[model samples]
Target: MSKHIVPLEYETGLAELRGDCARMAPHWVVPAKAAASPVAASLIHGVTVPPASARLIDAMSDYGD
Candidate 1:
């Protein structure tokens, strides 16, 4: 016969408290000047891949397929 192990029970409301704290924590906001700049904006929003890099990525994606 196999014995089943029971998981431990955490204190009630702990998860809710943690989530509340996380929601209340301060977050960084990008400056308007930086956001207005093209390069800075691209970096802040996401990485901008060059055409060559994109082609390389595409090639890699097809690898081992």
Candidate 2:
């Protein structure tokens, strides 16, 4: 006689979650901010923000309290 082992439904769900975690693994590592110094210098000099950058800042501002 031969026996078969079957995984439960939750096991499949867990496997899918594992795959998602793997795909997002790189996002877990913060990338270096290479342009930070230039941005900071511009801010210190009171340089005007471009319209696109200003819009991005406005959009991102709504993401938090």
Candidate 3:
């Protein structure tokens, strides 16, 4: 006989989460602000924030007391 594995709600949730993670593999494309000076680019578009980092930042903000 053959056995199979099934996903419970938690597993399904994790799978969906993984899918979301995969979809957002690319970091946010923050373009350099045209109106601002060259220095602004260093502050704004310097760091590329991947989706995972965005989620973590949101979670941290929520949990911060």
The candidate scoring highest on lDDT is: 2
| 10 residues in a row with least lDDT, candidate 2 | 34-43
Candidate 3 yields a Cα-based lDDT of 0.73
Write out the backbone clash pairs for model 1.
none
| TM-score, one value per model | 0.24, 0.26, 0.25
Per-candidate alpha-carbon RMSD to the true structure: 10.5, 11.8, 15.9
lDDT of 2 by residue, 1-65 (tens): 99999966554577898999999998897879776443455457656889998777778857523
> Candidate 3: RMSD over Cα atoms?
15.9
Residues 1-65 of candidate 1 have per-residue lDDT tens digits of 99999999877598898887788776646557745534554457555779997777778857524
Residue-level lDDT for 4 in candidate 2: 100
Of the two candidates 1 and 2, the one with more favorable TM-score, higher being better, is 2
**Candidate 2 TM-score, C-alpha based:** 0.26
Among the numbered candidates, top TM-score falls to 2
Error of 3 at 27 (Å): 45
lDDT for model 1, please.
0.72
